[model samples]
Target: MAVNYPNGKKFLAESHMPKTTKKKDLIYSNRGMTLEEEINSSNEHYLSSGRAVIHKKPTPIQVVKVDYPKRSAAVIREAYYRQSSTTDYNGVYKGHYLDFEAKETKNKTSIPLSNFHEHQILHMKRCILQHGITFVLIRFSFFNRVFLLNSSYLIDFWEDTMNNGRKSIPLAFIEEKGIDVAYGFNPRLDYLDAVDKLLEHTNK
Candidate 1:
């Protein structure tokens, strides 16, 4: 008599099983840290230093299946997102509501508008209507440059796209409209310095 498995393959000993690296683990090990990781670290630093109270919005996931190999351990085998998530980060800064989306692009010449979803743009617009400060932190990974772009500018281009305009925002336009955020040692991205400038301009 032979033992069988779910997929009609014989069960192998633990030592004979091939080792596999998770996609996120491979990304971290091979490409340093992702943009989200860097921003989360920066947010933690800001919170500890009393600079801001920002947090990453957790995406709700629906777990479909759980495998209980042992009574003490259970692993999720299947899951899906419950719904589309809003911006990456949101919180209160100096009594002002702050909301922002973070994105990275490898394209050297342009950042495509398609990278943004319709719901995200609408969320930013709604935030603005409520007098909340909204912006986007975009990184041009290839050039090792990061920028803080006001949501107003992003919305302008997004609306233009609806009118059948250009499909992407050129790097030149971004350089002109966006503020360059300095990469630093402590907070890492140092985007709040750029935010200060935006606040000053708005107040004036």
Candidate 2:
């Protein structure tokens, strides 16, 4: 299937990125699910439990070609995105607007800043000005560890990149500044737990 961006660039899904290591032996193991899938499951749990109502942002696409093998089975052969997306997920939590992006990296030491785009960062900045709770869910796939880093930290690092600063956020920096989100059976990734902690710290 051929998928293209609105600007005619080929769409490369994150799942298509090359894997460098086996994740089964890592801590907080994924059980073969991608980061996006795990977050989706957690969102479903949050919604069902009445804790939050967050959903992944869907990319609008224009189907260019489709093949129908059967009357009920149709396969999309080509498509184009209608516009660029701002963030991965957004909704409301406890009456606070929530907007966030999820990033996964096989690199154990750092997650590249390139995982985020300028337009996405701009959108997050605007949300922050509107008093929205904006943050990022970063997963180090090699270690199976996840952290919830506030968007302010991300934006600070992003702006530095334009001036020839480090291209990735070091794991040490994340460990010191971000909140650890435990992976569990029911919710998969308990990010809201970390979010509550972040809120408390901010309130103090």
Candidate 3:
């Protein structure tokens, strides 16, 4: 399939091909860094620096078909999008379990509430009830601004949307209720800083 970039550059980006690595180890690269890549790299940095234990949740996928020629590489012919059963990333941080969903949007004013799934929201609510830290890392690509919005604010508006007629969470509301995560060289989103603040509030 051909994809067109925002600048009208058309090209075809092939899907992942099956390959064997020594010991079946996962490889990390910044060559095509998506938001997911940045978060994973940041988590690695944190783990190495004794900062926190956070990791991206691996979603299990079922391969429907594959084609392999003799003495050649294998290609995935078909696959199904797996349902994510948990938050995007989760682990213990400073004695508290932290759960988060990282998302990006091109919209300049607000993030569409539809970007969040019902199951994902319920998972976060459960975490909050269990005294775990729960929040979302929302990146506004247009502005390069990231905010850590707690689950409480999200669910509040989410439920309200059912009858209140708001389809998206306005930027003003996010600015008022969410903690701004400063982007840095290390933890690209630096969401841990906001986590620290959440921890302080809970401890007080």
Give the best candidate by TM-score: 1
Q: What is the lDDT of residue 137 in candidate 3?
A: 86
TM-score per candidate: 0.80, 0.79, 0.76
- lDDT of model 3 at residue 160? 90
- The global C-alpha lDDT for each of the candidates, from Candidate 1 onward, is 0.83, 0.85, 0.78
User: Against the true structure, candidate 1 has what lDDT?
Assistant: 0.83
lDDT of 3 by residue, 79-196 (tens): 8889997789999887889999988899999999998999998998888889888888888887878888988888888899978779899988899888998867676557788989
Q: Give lDDT: candidate 1, residue 64.
A: 96
Give the residue spans of candidate 2 off by over 4 A: 1-29, 64-78
The pairs that clash in candidate 2 are: none
Task: Please report the TM-score between candidate 2 and the true structure.
Answer: 0.79
Q: Residue 91 lDDT in model 3? A: 92
The numbered model that scores best in lDDT is 2
lDDT of 1 by residue, 72-182 (tens): 335578999875657879999999999999999999998999889998999998999999999999899998888899999889999999999898888899899899999
Better of 1 and 2 by TM-score: 1
The candidate, 1 or 3, that scores higher on TM-score is 1
